[model samples]
Target: MFDLIIRNGKLYDGTENPWTRLDIGIVSGKIANIGDLGHEQARIEIDAQGLAVAPGFIDTHVHSDLLCTKPEIHKIKVLQGVTTELLGQDGISVAPVSELTKPLWQKQLKGLNGDIGEWPWHSIDEYLKFLDKSNLAGNVVYLVPHGNIRTLVMGFAGRKATRNEMQQMRELVEEGMRQGAVGVSSGLIYPPNVFADKEELIEICKGAAKYDGCFVVHIRNESHRSLEALDEVIDVARQSGVCLHVSHFKVAGQINRDKYEKALAKMDAGRAEGIEITFDQYPYTAGSTVFHAILPPWMHSGGTSEMLERLKDPVIRQKVKEDFQSNLDYENWVLNCGWENIIIASVSTEKNKRLEGKNVLQLAEIKGVEPADAAFDLLLEENAGVTMVVHWGNEQDVIYGMKHPLQIVSSDGIFGGKPHPRLYGTYPRVLGRFVREKKALTLEQAIRKMSGAPAQLLRLKDRGFLREGYWADIVVFDPDTVLDRSTYEDPLQEPAGIHYVLVNGELTVKDGEYLGTTAGQVIRRKT
Candidate 1:
């Protein structure tokens, strides 16, 4: 007898093949058989009625750092057919925290990820176990974040690391990988990380290379010097000989729209020269991040409290406003035109609740200040806890990236407050808007991007495909009807047509409702 069997489904199999009608048998949470198993017996069974079935989706790029407090985030993902989540994107997360740095790290990360509270810093391995023990609906994987280590040793300084600090950074990377991290992720656009020079990253990459881990980077300068930034990361791969993956790879700002193809060619050149490189893109054109990140890097040098203090200072505030006017980084970086382009997605304080859906320009209009000054004021008022969605990337760029063989899908999802629509709708939106509507990618190709491609990237042993002996992570959905319901204004809405989702042979979502079952495991890197 087996644990369960899902029968009569059209299986995509997570490859470059058409869906084939098949019956899947599950035993001990692994796929025991495919095709006819008419006589097989199981403890529990599901009749899929020939609806499309594929490997459960894997979100390669995500920021679910608050999983301990909000395991229901699995509902948001599993409901959309995501069975695994990779966290610790953009160089920051809760793990590897120390008694000295925990408070400071927590304060710094609040704006980027919603405050999950000051949880005690255990080792990264124990943190992952804590999440699994919380019973999240699906598996969790993580990348050792660069910012966490930097903060632990340097405390968000905007300068090069000392020789001693560099060694410490490398040792931390080794420690995190030893504790089961798949790789290292650097948020070069975020502070401390922004200050992390190429030599520092290349050395860390070499350290991660020792363990066969990929270096995931959110490269510096996605606008005016986007291609130059690409060259820097490519150079890092070249110097270290580590595999590289770019996060949410896109050119922001209106002026740089034409540079998308050139950016692709640069990455391709790196790939051609034998640097293993790939990228992840959400289906949507609008991207999300914390509003404060749009400001120049200098403002964030000393951690959140100090940053907030500077924001409140009239002289320092003028400098920020001047930078915005001078178009140093803000104008051509995230917000293309003005502050209104950045719609507020979330705010931590109830006092700033009304600002959640409004842009900085709108807030400024309400407060009778310039948009720059208003943004500064709001950050101070809320203690710098704010997130925003920037409507900037072109639909053409999104499609261009998604069509490339090297690129895969990732939500870069954040949670709580008014999160980005991708948090709820990334997978379905691709299946719905891009695949079904735009015809940019065939269903077979889209599934591979979400499943097989990511599994390969993570080097998973038994998941990401519909082959027997793989873990029974599967999704059954209606292709004709699957579509995202969330929008920029109402991002909390879930998608439609995801009928059933299974993680480790345990049904987590059935008939579009979460079963509240926690079968998720902390997927460790194979040493």
Candidate 2:
């Protein structure tokens, strides 16, 4: 008898094809059969009479590197039908740290990646092994972080790598890929990574290319010089021969919204020239990240400790304010969106807990200080551990990105106090608002972007499809009623219409309720 059988479901099969009536029989954690299995016997049966059965959603970009070890928080991903996720996004994550650098990264990344107390692993292999023993809620894959590699070779010094240091960093990249990383990821806007020039990126990318891995990057700039930034990465891919994937592709700011078409044309031209290019984006006009991202790159030169010290100096603060007003060179959130659009999402100190969910303008009035001073004081008080949501774009631009042929879906979710609604509402929001209401994408196209497309990009085999003999990671939801209930104000609310979810042939969510199962496995890149 089959271990489990799902009957009478309209199967989408994770492709851009129309749904078909079918039944799936699961045995020993893989799909044993897919057909008219109405007559089949099973130990358990789920009658998905009106639900759409498709491959489980694969989040292409996420910051769940540390959070995945905590089932209480990570189970929320499965409740929204995410059975697999790609972690180690933005080139900053936990792993491959020396005893000296570990504390620095923990302090710097506290707001972006919530504090997880103490860590046990120092290498990517050790980190992945730790997750294997942590009883994860969903399958996870990782990318070797550029920041970690940089800090390992040279402390977070703001300078280009020497030839010897370059060779060492390249060796580390290959070592991580050999340890089963799917690719290499870098956040060019985040320092030590910001210090890396195009030559450094090309050198490191060649290592990932040697393993046939993709190079996923949060480009240097996403606002005024977004096109130039795009060209830089495209050239890196061309020179290194690594597949390129842009993380959360967007043209931020009100004025830069018109650059969307030009960006797409550039990507199309790159693809036409035989370079593989793809991107993932959340369906939102606003974007979220650490609050310190608003500062000039030079301010973050040495590390978080150095940056905190600079925040204390009045002369440096003046320079910072001047740069905020005039520096169009970096992704200046202050110049493009203003302080009112930057809302504080999370803070590390109890004194600043009340500041969470308030914009800098509001904080300025409450604290009786200028907006820049208020933000700087919070950074100092919280030790650079503050996160913010910046309203940088509009709905029309979001819709346009969704309709792009090479685009995929990823929440880029950051979990903490008053986090972005994308943390809970990304997939259902697309199914409800974009597909059902706005007609921006059909259900088939949306499912493909969430499932098959990411699988193809990551080169994941025997998953992301409903084919026979594949691993039984699946989701059943009502297309007509599936919708995200979470909002920016009530950001913790769960979604609706996700009836069932399975990871590796085990049901984790049944009848819209989480069963608290940890059936997920650590998916490694196959060499």
Candidate 3:
């Protein structure tokens, strides 16, 4: 008897072709049989009638490196049909961190992943060993964080690396790769990483290239300076001979909405000229991040404590406000702090729970203050530790991004706070809203974007397809019944129509509820 049998499902095999009816059999955590497994008995059997069975979704960009360290994070991610993810996104995560910088890096990103609750490791390999023992619900791969590596070699100073420092940083990256990092990643838009000049990026990328890994970049700017940022990435790929994967490829700001085609053209041209570029984007228009992203980079240079100190100085605070006002669109900026849209998904501090899910704008109006001022005040009150989502992406841009072959989809999901609906909603939204409801893509094409494409990119051996020998990372759902019920107003609601989800041949989520089985492994490079 097989371990489990999923019978009577229409399988979308991630071939970018039509769905085919198939029966899947699993044994010992691998796909044991496909097609006519009709008469075979199994230890467990699932009647997958009227469901579309396909490979479980792989998230190419995520901030879950720190989240997975916590045990509860599994239920939140697995229920969304994510079987694998590319962690250490946007240049902030704990890998390749030195003893001197670990404490500060932990504090700086507390808003993104929450406090590191007694993490014991110091090196990338040690952390991976811990992850293996953590027993996550799905597989995780990492892009060795550029900011973490830079901070390890050079402290959190906003300056270019010296030649000696640069060499040491390169060595650290090589070490991370040897320890199983899939690639190097950076947030040229965030501090410490923002401090690295283009030449520095090129050097680190070259080290990644030695391991045949890609360089995943959150470019310097996404609005006014998007083209320049894209060009810089292209130049890095050209010089370092590393593949480039652009994270959350979007044209932000009202004025830049029309620049999508132009930006895409530049990327296409670079690829034609041998840059080997691919990118990932979310299905939504609004982006989510910490409230601090609006502050000028210089104000955040020394670290979180130093940044808060400057916040107390009237002159510096005023300058910070002016800088934010210059870039922030006042009319559209929603107060994510406490509003109908601002749901508090996770709060490390017990006292802040009362502020959850209320609009920052509404809260500000109640306090007789501006929205920015309210956001600033909330951050200070929370000791510069609050996560917020901005309502600023254009639907046209989201739709436009979906139609691109090179642009795979990712949620950029921030787990804390009443997180944006996209965290739970992105994959299903793409399958249900974009594919089945709107018909932007055929069901076959949609599955390819989520499954086949990302698997090929990440170089997973036999995970993304429906072949007999692949791992049983599968999802079975009804296309007609599939829909993302989660919304900005109620972000925690589970999606509907996903009948069963299996990871490593074990059912982690079955019948739309978590089964509490943790079969996820830390996916490592084979070489």
The lDDT per prediction is: 0.84, 0.93, 0.80
Query: Lowest-lDDT window of 10 residues in candidate 2?
Result: 252-261
Per-residue lDDT for 1-527 in model 2, tens only?
99999999999988789999989999999999999987789998999998899999999999898888888988789988999999888889897899999998998888988877898989999999999998798999999999999999999999999988988999999999999899999999998899999999999999999998999999999998999999999999999999999999999887887788899999999999999999999999889999999998998899989999999999999999999999998999999999999999998888878988899999999999999999999998888888999999989988998999899999999999899999999999999999999999999999999999999999998899999989999999999899999888889999999999999999999999989899999999997
Q: What is the TM-score of each candidate against the true structure?
A: 0.97, 0.99, 0.94
Candidate 2 vs 3: which has more lDDT: 2
> Ranking by TM-score, best first?
2, 1, 3
Summed backbone clashes in each candidate are: 0, 0, 14
TM-score of 2: 0.99
Show where candidate 3 strays beyond 4 Å.
69-71, 327-350, 358-360
Best by TM-score: 2
Indicate the TM-score of model 1: 0.97
Q: Rank the candidates by lDDT, best first.
A: 2, 1, 3
Question: Candidate 2: lDDT of 324?
Answer: 91
